[model samples]
Target chain A: MSELTYRDALNLALKEEMRRDPSVVVFGEDVALYEGSFKVTRGLLAEFGEERVKDTPISENTIVGVAVGAAMGGLRPVAELMTVNFALLAMDQIVNHMAKVRSMFGGQTHLPMVVRMPGGGGSQLGAQHSQSLESYFMHCPGLRIAYPATPADAKGLLKTAIRDPNPVIFLEHELLYNSKGEVPDDPEFLVPFGKANVVREGSDVTVVAYARMTVLALQAATELAKEGISCEVIDLRTLNPLDVETFVASVRKTGRAVVVEECWRTAGLGGDLAHRIHEACFDTLRAPVRRVAGLDVPMPYSREIEKLCIPRVETIAAAVRDVLAASV
Target chain B: METKLRAVLPDHELVKLYEQMVIGREFEEACAEQYTKGHITGFLHLYSGQEAVAVGATAGLHKDDYILSAYREHAQAIVRGAEPKRVMAELFGKATGLCKGKGGSMHLFAPELSFMGGYAIVGGQLPVACGLAFSAKYRQEDRITACFFGDGAVNQGTFHESLNWARLWELPVLFVCENNFYGIGTEVHRSSALPTVHKRTCGYDIPSEKVDGMDVVAVFKAVKYAAEKVRESGRPYFIEATTYRFRGHSMADPAKYRSAAEHEIWKSRDPIPAFARRLLDEGIAAEEELEAIRKRCTATVQDAVTFAEESPWPEDRQIWEDIYV
Candidate 1:
């Protein structure tokens, strides 16, 4: 195993995939020369030819549409949309064409394409660029949604997404790109979708999250452990074909659950998970499942106000403490 | 550069165009007939009067070239190698249909024939066609992508974005705008500030021309030239086939926006019968031959109806079949 940041893991995955498959190509704003806004595509242009690692115009729809056509024409395309907020421009291609093509065509073709978008709202980028669109994509069928927290899971899940025949909406948390972890050095360490990882096993409560939110939950779990509170943190690696059984098992065992989300509270993915938890583990639950989520308002430009929107370690810890208090 | 109509396409080719137009008209009428009988369901946008746009343009393409169009594409698919029986079955929502009844009439597909799909979103096919052209060019294939859409689609952002991208990359895309003057209830005049659809491409320096959509020979000549330019230069070319839709936008539309007098003025120039008269007047074919062509088109459509009626519904288990690979 080697220590790598989440960004490097993503870059390594692209490099390895491009080297393995001649048809695999990467493109987007600054993805070629500047190596992406978050530097996730650093050194890709050097390794792959300019034709393969292309820089596209600011047209997000065209970028995705091109990837869709290229994928249908027997190429594996990883089209980065810069940020999830910008995905609104290409929503037609994503929802109408990419997600529906294979099924609509009656299985005549497969869209083996991946759309990477930096998501979630911690960095104070404000309303236009900071919205988390994972829930929007999760509601749609004919798509696989992946959000990895650690470097290891990032690399493994990305490779699996590249290999999978469906169109994958890969949500990369902008905050987690700088976070470092010990990624397995094995070239073939592929992670399967619909599987949740219990990062820190515990007995009292289950905190469900993915991507950067998982890191926050982990930090809260660390503090909660110090307070003699055992928290089982479940990292939902993929949200669409969700590993409900894992959450069900955890909720049944712990008898208390808290869903931590970086997105807004109103009609959020956390709400969906909380509803599922209630349906599956109602008798087992000692307290109502609580949600520590982002404020249901547009993210402000001020750093302090932006911090107020997303869930911090203390915020998650407080939510877990409330569940603990309720049980007592 | 204006070649004689007979010189460009011989007498036999004219007859074929007539037959294709007739098939398109007859097929659309049949769809309306079946829809009324509760056989075919969903949004049925009849290409009753816009038949020449498909026939004239598809005639200019090789079998290997790609064809992408908006929702009004039953005629385009028929002109481009899709079997009539399958197309009919598609409209009928039968399992034997082109898309196995999943897409109904709006999303027909024949990748083997290089006919991509009939997208429902107005300008959704623009970028897709450009991407298909990019693939063809990047793979060093000499194929061109003919993208067809209505006048209403020109107002969409994808149209301008795709035009710029196609020109910037020098991709082979023949942007065929069948400007039938209506986007649902809104007329082209109501939508576009500058009404000429072909002139819109001038901003991107994509060469374009306006063709008489009612005249099959004119549409054929213009599309042929545009397709050739796109193939030769590997750059996007635009052609506005100024046609008219004889029927309402879809089966349910009342067409309350336009007047009967205006419709009559255009109907006098209906492409199918007008071309048939020209075929005989130009000494291309006898009146008996025209009757024979109509009989043949009727037979083809009749066989298609039988195939659709007999075709089975898709199995229930197939619902989750092709969403993923």
Candidate 2:
């Protein structure tokens, strides 16, 4: 294992995939010469040349639509939307064409492509820029969504997404880009979809989260441990092919659960997880399934208020404490 | 370089074009008949009067050249070499359909024929066509992508974006706008600030022109010239084929919005009979031979209907099969 930032891990994944397959191509706004606004595509143009690594116009819909066509024309295109918020502009292509192509065309072709977007609401970018739209993607069928919380999963899941024979939505958190971690040096390492990782195993209560929220959940688990309360933090690596079984098994063992999500409370992924946990571990539960989701409001601009809107370590720990203190 | 009508194409080739047009006409008529008989369902957009645009443009293209079209695409697919029986089966939602009955009428796809697909959304196929051309250029292939859409699609954001990108990338794309005058019920004058579709491409620095969509030879010649220029220059070219549709926008439309005089004027220039008259006047084919070709087209369509009726429905388990690889 080697220490690398989340951004570098993603860059390494792109470089390795491009080197492994000539069919793989990368393009987006300022992805080539600019090395990407986020620098995730740094050195890709130098390594792959302009033929494979391209800088496209700031046309989000066409960017995705072109990727759909390129995938149909036998090229594995990894398109970046700059950010998840801009993906709203390409919703027509994403929802109408990319998601519907294979099924609508009766499986005549496969779209081996990936759409990478950096998303989350913590950097004080305000409502327009700071939005967690994973629920939107999870709501749509014919799409696989991966939001890695660590550098290791970033590299592993990205490589898996590149090799996947269907469209994948790869969400990266802006805050986690600078965070360093020990990532496996193996270029062949792949994180399979539909499997949850129990980050900190415990027997008291199960805490389920993913992406940036997973980091907070881990922190909350550490804090809960100080109070003599053991919390099992299950990091959901993928949203669509959700590893409910892993979390459900954890809920059965712990006899309590709390789902943490960064998106708005209503229609959030946490609600879905809470429902599933209740359904799967009804008899085994000590208290009701709790959901610690972001407040049902657009992300505010001020840091203090924004902190209140998103799920924090304190909020997660409090929810875990509530579930543990509740009478059966 | 204006060749006489007799010399525009050889006798055999001219007759072949006429035969394809007849086949397209007969196939759409059969689809209409099948729709009423309850064999075909869904949004059926017939290409009855706009045959020449699909037939002529497809004939001008090399077999390896890719083709993409909108929902009104049966003629485009058939002309691009998709078997009529399979296309009909797709319309019938049979398991043996071109798309295995997954796409139905508006999404026929034949990858082997390089017929990319039939996009249901207006202007949805433009960027995809650009991407196909980009792939060809990136792989150092000498093929171009022919994208067909209607006048209604010109106002879509994708149309403008695709044209700009295609020109900026110098990709080989032949944008064929079949101006059937209406986007469902909205006429061109009401929908577009500038109703001339070809002129809209001037903003993108892409060269474009207009042709008589009712004349098969005109569309064929214009597309042939434009496609060659696109292939040579590695840039996109636009052609507005001024055509008319005899049928309603869809099976449900009664076409009450159109005036009788406008329909009559367009009907007089019906491509099939007009091309037949030119063929007879030019001594390309005898009356008996032309009549025989029409009968053959009729039989082929009938055979396709029979095949679609005999084809089986897709299994229930297969619904979840193709969403991923």
Candidate 3:
């Protein structure tokens, strides 16, 4: 195992995948020479040359549409939208074409491609730049969504997503890029989809989250452990092949749950997760499932107010305590 | 007369082109009849008057070249060797359809035949065509990608974006715009700032031209030359085929917006009869031969309709299938 930052791990994953498969090509706005807005594609153009590592025009919809076409024409294309906020611009291609191509074409074609977008709040990028739209993609069928929190999982899940025969929406958090962790050096190391990682083991309360929220949940779990309130932190690796079984089992054991999401409170993924937990562990639950979600408002530009919109470690801990205190 | 005919193609190939156009017209007419009877449902955009564009363009490109089009693509698919029966069956939503009843009339796909797909969204297929061309260029393959869209699609952002991308990347793609004058109900003059579609490619630095879409030989010659230029230069080319749809945009449209005189003028230039007249005048084929070709085409369309009627419905279990790999 080698210690690597989340960004480095992702860059390594792209390098490894491109080396492993010649058909794997990378392209997006500033992805080639500029190395991507997030630098996840750093050193790709130097290694793969201009033909494979291309910098496309600033056309978000066409970026994804071209990826879909490349995948259909037998090339594995990993396209990047500058950020999740810009993905809304490309929603037509993402939802209408990329997600619908395979099923609408009657299984005759499979799009082996990945669209990477760096998103999540707390950086004070304002309303348009800082938004969590995972639920928007989750609402659509025929797409696999992967949002990894740690370096290891980031590398593993992205490699797996690159090799998967279906179109994958790979979400990366902007703040987590500098965070470091141990990652497997093996090019073959892959984290299978639909399996939630049990980041922390406890029995009092189950904290379910993904991407940047998962990192905060782990921190909250550590802080909760010192307070004699053991919280089991579950990092949902992939949202689509949602490991409802793992979370359900955790809720059954803990008899309480707190779902944390960075997206809006209204119609957030938390609502769906909490509902599923309630349905599966209704008899076993000692308390109604609680949710710590992003404030239902456009993300504010002020750093002070921006911090209040998304879930912090303190907010996660408070939610866990709230769920624990509400025990029947 | 023989010299004029030979300038476009051999007599035998011209005859074959005529047969393909007749098949397209017959299949679309049949689809209209079936739609009226409620056999084929959903948005049915028939390629009735635009037969020459599809048939001629398909003939112009290599068999290995990738072809993608807008919703009015039944003729394009059939011209590219997709079985007419399978395409009709797809419209009928049968299990034996090209897309196994999943993709209806608007989304016919035959990857094996190199007919990529029929996109319902205006200008959606343009970027995809670039991708296919990108793939071909990446693999050092000799094939090119042929993308067909209507005049209405030119107003879409994808049209501009895809054109710029194709030229910037130097990808081998042939963008064919079937300028049928109207986008649904609004005519090109109303919808576009510049109604001249082919002239729009100049902004992207891609050379383009306009062709008389009603003449099969003219479309074939233009597309053939442009496709070869794309192949040899490894760059994009554009052709705006000036044409009109004989019918409404889809089955639901009554086309009350079009004037009788305008419709009559376009109908007078009906490609099938015009080409048949040329063949007769050039002594390429006798009237009896043309009649035989029409009979054969009618039989082929009838066979397609019968196949669609006889085919089974997709099983209930298939709904859960094909969503993922």
**Candidate 1 ranges beyond 4 A from true positions:** B1-5
| Alpha carbon lDDT at B18, candidate 1 | 94
Q: Per-residue CA lDDT of candidate 1, range A1-328, in tens?
A: 9999999999889888888888788988989999898999999999887878888889998888888887777778899999999999999999988899888888888888999999888777778888987888988998899999999999999999998888899999888898899998877889999999989899999999998989989999999899999999999999978999998999999999999888778888999999999999988899999999889898898997888888999999999999988983
TM-score, first chain, each model: 0.98, 0.99, 0.99
**DockQ numbers for every candidate?**
0.70, 0.82, 0.84
Candidate 3: residue A186 lDDT (0-100)? 90
Q: Give the per-residue Cα lDDT of candidate 3 at B319.
A: 99
lDDT of 2 by residue, A116-232 (tens): 999998899999999999999999999999999999999999999999989999999999999899999888989998798999899999999999999999999898889999999
Model 3 stretches astray by more than 4 angstroms: B1-3
Q: Lowest-scoring 10 consecutive residues by lDDT in candidate 2 chain A?
A: A319-328
Q: Higher lDDT: candidate 1 or 3?
A: 3
**Candidate 3: clashing pairs of residues:** none
lDDT per model vs. reference: 0.89, 0.93, 0.94
For model 3, residues A1-328, the per-residue Cα lDDT tens digits are: 9999999999999999999999999999999999988899999999999988999898999999999999998999999999999999898899999999999899999999999999988888999989999999999999999999999999999999999999999999999999999999999999999999999999999999999999999999989888999999999999999999999999999999999999999999999999999999999999999999999999999988899899999999998988878899
Chain B TM-score against the true chain B, candidate 3: 0.98
Per-residue lDDT value at B2 in model 2: 39
